[model samples]
Target: MKLAALVIAAACLLAPPSLAAPWLRTRGLGRVINGTATDIADFPWMASMQILDNSGCGASVISSTWALTAAHCVLASQEMPGAYTTLRVGSSSRASGGVRLDVAQMIKHADFHMSTDDADNDIGVIQASEPFPLGSSVQVVNLPGDGYDAPAGLPVTISGWGATATEFNPVYLQRADMHVLDRDTCRDMMADVATVTLGMVCAGDPTMAICYGDSGSPLVYGDMQIGIASWTRPGCISTTSVYTSVGNFRAWIRDNTGV
Candidate 1:
């Protein structure tokens, strides 16, 4: 129930010491390998989470005060209370051009867990110290209705400000047009690698991939957020990317954060 428990669940490989999420085998940019760059104005809901001072993960604005992300994304901060958690909304650059707001609290799912290869209830909601100044460049995205599941092959787009395969440090947010892959197929592809669960949904793009900063970002169809970026293969192999089902956690979000 406590985030400290998540810190104990960490098991990383080939990853940088500066990165703290449980994105296995991904050094710094496990995903967004060949994604296309875009401006934050196009995806105003994008929340660039900063742990300490560096870009830590991605999130989505849901209200004037709350933003949504992944549990693992904030796990490291649980051990460092003094660490400042900042969210840069309405920013195109990973480190600049956005109104930076310090995070006041972070709450993960009560049942959140992470293993060497798999994670469950990975959702997290963070609150800013004060309400964000909402506008055209800073807006909220809608979540899927309770129990509304994203079916296989549903088209979706994921956005983040992570490193690309060509640019180790990209300045603009990246978007990957992807599609949902049924869980049965996802489990088959991830065999011996991870354990797929009802709590998670799978997606991928044949010609694109995600990056390190993609973790905790939104997986959207139209204006609805259905998933939260979770994990992927070591090199975005098969372009397979996993995300926490925002569609599956409506009550959890309301009960936990009143969002």
Candidate 2:
């Protein structure tokens, strides 16, 4: 299927537009909100991959030995030699007892097109050198599959240490509550995309949207994770925040990453 068509079909059951001025710009500093683990040490896989100093990307643990993130995050590195050499996954707050697993392999979504707005198959998996310790307090998020579908209007939780506002990446993690948007509503919101397809899911309020730093963060609904923050329009505050729907590609993801 075409990228736009995939986004529409993938999100045919999902649901974007006004914008509010960004409140503040966080410089790699994240806030630990309520319900979040009290100690930074608790979240072992909630990491920020550093390309220099900025939190260029975010990733979540999906299995003891694998992590899920955006395909774009490792595309360049995979294409080149030794580009992602220092990539690390651990608490963005600091490096302590957290494991620094080398990215033994990277698998990008075949349909991902970096030049286009469509994020078809924008997902990717990073295999860690070692399995995350079972009782290490690092919990792997379960992915949505086998008829998993979030009901419309359901409230979902999305967390990231990305930029709090526009043009900046936060230093600490933050969580936001968002509602799922159906395909029709999202298409209208993504009117500029030429076409909205079946591989994408839209989330967040029109006024409060995910930003650049949030790419690859999990969009959790209930016990299953359904989406990954993939991209936002030119302005992060735009009503439509495109996500790579996990449910739509569950089989493909499992096959490629062997998770």
TM-score winner among the candidates? 1
Q: Which ranges of candidate 2 are over 4 A from the true structure?
A: 1-45, 52-54, 79-82, 85-97
Identify the leading candidate in terms of lDDT: 1
Q: Residue 243 deviation, candidate 2, in Å? A: 0.7
* Cα lDDT of model 2 by residue, 125-212, tens digit: 8777777654454667778774455566878867665544321434555666778888678878776653456777877665555654
Least accurate stretch of 10 residues (summed lDDT) in model 2? 1-10
Candidate 2 contains a number of clashing pairs equal to 26
lDDT of each: 0.72, 0.57
Question: Candidate 1: what lDDT?
Answer: 0.72
- Candidate 1: C-alpha RMSD to true structure equals 5.3
- Evaluate residue 160 in candidate 2 and report its C-alpha lDDT on the 0 to 100 scale: 68
As a whole number from 0 to 100, the lDDT of residue 5 in candidate 1 is 11
